[model samples]
Target: MRVHKFTFAALAVAAGLTLTACQSGEDGAAQGGASSAPPGSPAASAPASPGGGSSSGGTDQSGGKNSAGTGSDGKGTAAGAGSDGTGKAGKCRTGDLEITAIDSTVGGDSDGTVAVQLKNRGGQDCTLSEYAGVDLKTSAGSLSAKRTGEHPGPVVLKKGKAVSFGVTYPLNTSGGSGVRVTGLVVTPPDETKSVTLAWPGAATLPVTEGTGSPVKVGPIGSAGQGG
Candidate 1:
């Protein structure tokens, strides 16, 4: 009887030990799973959180860099546009003009007028807003013509177009007492360079920059126009 009881107790103790070992292994596995995701698991493969991981953070940084670059390019383009807006054609120069004495008196000498024409041979358009300065070349000295009209408005001289003005001088009708003019030196408005052109008509016994009133120059206009 005693031996049977002892055998039964030993069997029960062994069975209890096995049950405790199984329970301990199961608890350790559950704790490991709850603490962190294992490698190659679905949780480990998921994308990073908004503010945390390498993948999402790198993408956001790249987007920020692109936005900054775009802003810099936009500023440069705006500055270039401003610079181009201020670029306009300049005034006409003497080297760009073809100057000539077109017509003069046929018979009369006193109060005689000469038409001076200026054509733009410059490849581009230019502005001419005032009277041209004229000087009659003579044996005595150069005679400057006085402006006769009011202030003229601005006019654009397109390429290949022409503008004209009149030069009026008095003649000494007395015998051999008049100024003898050979040529003219014309200076365009607001220009420093000059152009020389020969007098269109007779050189002797007629032309004189007036003694009483100065020789008169009319405002700029089209051909056959002006005072």
Candidate 2:
């Protein structure tokens, strides 16, 4: 009986050792297998951690692209709309105009350019479709600055601005002479909206005689003459 009990105890000890060895071998195999896995092994495929910022990061990138596209498109559309609006508004921005200065003096022995300055006392721009014919009154027979056509037609001037038109004239001789320039309102292309200025005399300028230099018609008793 004592021997059987002793044998049984030894068998139990051996079995326990064998079990421990098997468990150690299994653990070693598992560790080695895990270490040998490639960089992108199934173990590397990790789940999104709690509080991770990847979701927000992806959202930020996707949203950034969409937001950028939206902003660019909106800017482009706004710019295009502004341009179109400005163009349309410009066509209607102009108003009526009147002649301010008409100096018909010549430069020298030869005919020189006649400078006619028109000012917009009104709030808008004016377009003179055609030049109204006028005999620039001179002490001598009136010199003609023939209105071949409208001067500076289709000119769109800004408010309180002045525009200039030039006409050439021959100075027969140099002398101080008073001349009156006339202008008549006209509508171009259509030719139907014409307004005749029966006595609407343009500003007067005096021509300096011998020098053929220009002189100005100024307030009476004023020192200098208008050129």
Candidate 3:
């Protein structure tokens, strides 16, 4: 009877120890199998990156969309990016151009055209587009000429290269005085600044203001084409 009691007590103790070991193993396994990020890991603490962490390649970001190579409006191309992949050549500024004006025909006495030239004086390449703004400085006043041709799309002006435009005007042929043009105030396309050039020859005859303005300007073209 004493041996039976001792054996039963030992069995009970062993079973209790085995059950406790199993429970401890299960608790440790549950903790080790957790999916949550550990403390101090990047996934636990890093803030969300913008644009879903997508690379933008330096494009513009607006309205939660990428508008690369497009201006702020998203409808126009970026300033330095051209459609034909003329990358990084910016629009020509007035200060970077050298302007000159000359009579298109030699020894003109009547209606004539003036070939106005613009040379890219800057060290880098630039672009020019649209009609050049031209004003004839006359004895009467500054006579602004009207544009006459379709806009020649943007033309790349390489360093030291040049382009030309045309300005047509009816000279005084009635043996009477007409508008006496003395000089020219010229502005490049899309430019706010202007340059002044002296008229090629002796002062023009005369057509006083108020009579009528027949002066016309044309688009830019090859250096000597007179537009």
Candidate 4:
């Protein structure tokens, strides 16, 4: 009976040692698997949060550079448009012109005609159109000419260029009493101011009262020659 009890105690001791060894081996294998994990593994990659910041920083830098480039281009385009002078220049003022008259003889019952010349003496270009308003003033009386139904084309005069028009009146061939004209008053197209030019003494402007003013005016044309 003593021998049997001793044998049972030894068997129990052996079984306890085997169980402890198996548990230690399993724990060591688990620790090794955790330590040897690759860097690309989900568990190992958790500390790569700074990589996301670097990616965002690169994108922001690119966007900022693109925005700056676009802004510079827009500014350059605006400046170019401003310098292009999209609006045209203004019309010429009355004070910037020169007016003159030349005596010309006409055919038929008409006595004579006066060629009025208008020159642009200003530094810029100008436009002139329609018939010139003309009135003959003398010591005897004042006589205004009737504008013809014909309309002249618009004439653009550059600096130092000129334009002209014609004025005609009937001759007093019957030797009746006629009014003598001393000076002529000319009003340019679209202008309110009047310019007075001295009539040439060589020519006479005969006017017959009550016969309806026989005076007639033509359209504006190229200067130095009448149209």
Per-candidate local distance difference test: 0.72, 0.42, 0.76, 0.70
User: How should the candidates be ordered by TM-score, best one leading?
Assistant: 1, 4, 3, 2
The local lDDT score (0 to 100) that residue 190 gets in candidate 2 is: 26
What 10-residue stretch in candidate 4 is worst by lDDT? Answer: 75-84
Weakest ten-residue segment in model 1 by summed lDDT:
76-85
Model 3: per-residue lDDT, tens digit, 1-227?
99999999999999999999999889979888654688888665655468666343455656565445556676756544332355657888898888888777557446577889988888788878868898888887888888886766888788888889878777666677655778888989898899999887335744545655677888888325322
Model 2 C-alpha lDDT per residue in residues 38-155, reported as the tens digit of each score: 7886545544557763333344354354333445446522333223344421221222444433345443435434444444555443333333333344434444343443233344
lDDT of 4: 0.70
Count of residue pairs whose backbone atoms collide, per candidate: 0, 11, 5, 0
Per-prediction CA RMSD (Å): 8.0, 12.3, 9.7, 10.9
lDDT of 4 by residue, 93-125 (tens): 578878888876645534577788888888776
TM-scores of the models, in the given order?
0.58, 0.31, 0.57, 0.57
Rank by lDDT, descending? 3, 1, 4, 2
